[model samples]
Target: MDNTANPAFDVTKRLRATSPKSVAIHEEAARVMAAEIVGTVEIACPVYIESASGSRLTDVDGKEYIDLTMGFGPHVLGHRPASVEKALAEQITRGWHWGIHNPLQHRLGELLLEAAPCGEQVVFCNTGTEATMYAIRAARAFTGKSVVAVFDGSYHGVHDYALLVAERSSDRRNPAPRRRGAGIPSEILETVAMLPYNDEAAFDIIRENRDRLAAVLVEPVQSSNPRTDIGPWLRELAKVCREAGVLLIVDEVITGFRLAYGGGQEYFDVDADLATYGKALGGGLPIGAVAGRTDVMSVFNTGSERARPIFSGGTFSGNPLTMAAGIAALTEMRDTPDLYPRLNGLGDRLAEAINRHARQHKMPVTMMNAGSMFHLRFAEGQIRSSRDITSRYVKAEHVFYQHLQECGVLVPGIHLAFVSAAHSEADIDAVAAAVTASLDTLRNDGMI
Candidate 1:
């Protein structure tokens, strides 16, 4: 094989000259920062972004690229949307942070409750991690149960209980829980159960563990394995949870607002006892919340005697800046009836075009999407669940994304991409073209 044909080698050479500023910045940081920070696949190019606006990003080196990550699911309205920006600017003048009560929280909470099917009340927090942690705590306190069940391939947050993966050697239908990373105690394994995604066998597990289970947390669309045909499965899961007397906590961190105004609850037509939200909720700002039935959420209320009050507070939980942004974003989305339809249509068209191209050329790649959320899979077959994925084309997959970057398109390290309302038809066209060119380049180089 010719060395020049390797995309990684070519990418390195091109970036070194065109992105000298970014390379220098990365070098400086590498000397002081932890090795793990600078070595992630997400930052593969060391291309530091200088500014972003409306589906495009400019790097410090003055090169521009179309951004598909969309702030990893937060910037659904695109970066620096006028309404959110205006709200933030005005909020800054009034003092962005105050440790006291502010009327902004009331309006934001009202908007959330109105949109979320299960949301009667909301509790604010700093990030999705905190929101899930608090939701789990409340579920346990409310039910007096010791266990929380999570599905395989579902990512909730960085908390100890949320960082579980199914043991690879265990049975696919009945998998054992394993810690994803270090620092998580082995004892946490006892408090959590891992279930297969998109499988009816999970229903049996829920029933068997009903006595000890407090809540069954799930992501409507798994980030690692996105699919559009999971509505039936989700609806059935909700029914099972109800039958077993276990609370269902849908982790809408990635799907909230992006799928629809009501998030996964409306998209999948399922109700939850408790639902956690983040990502798009704050209009590109850092925020998280748990919204649920009044009875279950009342566990946070000290005045309620139904259950012991669970401690939930944060210094910046309901900061005025985030509240202003959330209200502005939600208000625009609610008023604009056609926004979701247009966004979802764009997603459908993009997926169709790329998948058609792959089929016509016999490429072993598939673009799976759920509304605007997308994931590029290396295999070309029906993917019912994350366990069906194979790592045979891992090297080619990395090279394909590198080639995409060379063509002025950007996707995150995990290959989970999203489209926003700000992405025009022309923008989608360009993305489709870039994907085709990348696949062709990979084929020519004998990488795919």
Candidate 2:
């Protein structure tokens, strides 16, 4: 590990030096916060944002950037969209939050159902993590089974269930479980079975463990790696889960609303027993939901079930602010013609342009995408899963991210990026040029 003084950190040092105010704030934040920033560690440098609008972000140092991360895949319409702002303003006047069911909840629920054909009913939660956790619980409650099958290199949430799988499972066919971090017990890890992504052999694993398995949870389009050819494999997985009486939970937290109005289910043309949603669903606000077939989701219904219903509730589950924003976002998605195609086209163009530049320079870098969600891998050759994204890519990716930042573009340091409706062709071209220049810089320094 090149932990000794490095160029990427040096670039960050240079960038941060320009913004002493952000540096001061980050220093203070480190004193109080666990990680200097909230959420996953995505970048080598911390660029503090003073404000964001449209496709751009303004740092505290007054440097502007073309934001490609788009708030980590939630801002489909981009930062401070008019429709979301208007809905939020109106909802703020009406009320911010309420413990009771609000009318806006029903409206948003209807929109979700209309968008997702698999959604016969819906339950609200605070984040994608909560939605996925509850979705697994509901599946367990309905199936009377304890074990849940999830794919390797796929992240459902930060919960214990999702973190059970090790980085390199010794047994590729039947991966061994390992704690993502300490404090989680073996008992919790035992309940999870990790399988390989896009591997047809996952069917056999599902069949062998049918009795103990309650659900098969997966992201139709993994936000971590972003492969475009997993649709057929996902369909097969969904079918096998149905045949085995195991519920299928599609974690569409990142792909939902961003890929299309109906998300991965719609794009792949597959049906899931339950689908967990978040990210783009609330426009820019924090919100999540579990939507699915009435029969499977009825585990949450109090009156219908003799046993106590699955415990699913949050203080601000169906709060008016998020509901209003969701309603507005979905409405815009539904009413706007060619929205998905346009966004997807922009994504395709960006990926193509970058890949072309990489090929011309004989760089090892490769860009992969599923509509607007994309990732840059430094090492090439058929990246099917997160495990396929080798450690060799880490240093190059950091260098690329830092160079792009220097070139006035912002992407998540180590995660997938999102292009928004606000991103223009010019933005795509600029990013392509930045990629070429960044790769050139790395080659000159013998870093690539």
Best by lDDT: 1
Structural similarity to truth (TM-score) of each candidate:
0.97, 0.96
Candidate 1 global TM-score: 0.97
- Candidate 1 C-alpha lDDT tens digits along 1-448: 8868556778667767777898888889879877644233453567778999999999898889999988888988888899999999999999989979899998999999998999999999989999999999999998999899999889999899999998778999998889998999999999999999999999999999899999999998899888878889899999999999999999998988989999988999997999999989988888999999988899999988864599989999999999999999999989999989999988888899899999999989889998899998889588877877888898888778877887898888767899998899999999999999889888887877
* Candidate 2 residue lDDT tens string, 104-215: 8989999988887589999998899999999999999989999998887788888888876655836666667678888888898779988877888889999989999999
How displaced is residue 339 in candidate 2, in Å? 0.7
Rate residue 158 of model 2 by lDDT. Answer: 86
Off by over 4 Å in 2: 1-10, 36-44, 167-169
After aligning candidate 1 to the native by TM-score, how far in Å is the CA of 251 from where it should be? 0.9
Best by TM-score: 1
Worst 10 residues of 1 by lDDT: 35-44
For candidate 2, give the lDDT: 0.85
